[model samples]
Target: MRISPSDEFLADLERLLLDQGVAPDQARAAAVAVGVEWGGQSVYIRLRGPYLARAVAAAYDGANVGELATRFRISRAQVYKLLNKANEADRPQLEQARLPGT
Candidate 1:
């Protein structure tokens, strides 16, 4: 199936928020807010630190590192770092899923 750039971006953002422990409803709301805010801006608004890392990581799943780097305007190394951070965040969940009861 095909997805528009805007839809892909929003989906990536939502996933990033959700991975960071935001509730599904809140993630969608936050993604919408981000779109609205950025849509009205004439200049670029840079996202940094952990938030950017998470966003890049989430986007990586749907896109390659090169695409993510271009989309987020970062280097490949940075993308790897972000993806690594995201993986770290998922470690606990991964461990839980491996448990017998789970």
Candidate 2:
């Protein structure tokens, strides 16, 4: 079965990386690590006020997905993925509104 990333999951992972001073690409891998599911692994993220959430949300508001990707330093594929996950079902929550350190 193919794996899909949950918006909440990715947001939390991003916050964790931000807290640890990790790079986005590094955080990408870590995000994927948790985003993947196949049993055995058991971890999840519940972000609040995450950077990507607000950033992506703002970008997704009035710009094309491609443009948003460039602005965020990610690929089109990643942008599309974020867009889909970020729709109503993936809107940032109050609990998921914080970064790692702040």
Q: After best superposition, candidate 1 residue 71: deviation in angstroms?
A: 1.1
Count of backbone clashes, every candidate in sequence: 0, 7
Every candidate's lDDT? 0.83, 0.67
Find the 10 residues in a row with the least total lDDT in model 2.
40-49
Q: Which residue ranges in model 1 land beyond 4 Å of their true spot? A: 1-46, 100-102
Clashing pairs in 2: 47-96, 48-96, 48-97, 48-98, 49-96, 49-97, 49-98
RMSD of each: 10.3, 12.9
Model 2 / residue 64 / CA error / Å: 1.5
Cα deviation at 54, candidate 1, in Å, is 1.9
Can you write out model 1's per-residue Cα lDDT over 1-102, one digit (the tens) per residue? 897677678799999989889999999998898788775455454676788988787666655989988888889988888888889999999998895876
For lDDT, the strongest prediction is: 1
TM-score of each: 0.48, 0.33
Lowest lDDT 10-residue stretch of candidate 1: 39-48
lDDT of 2 by residue, 42-82 (tens): 54534323566556766675558777777777787877666
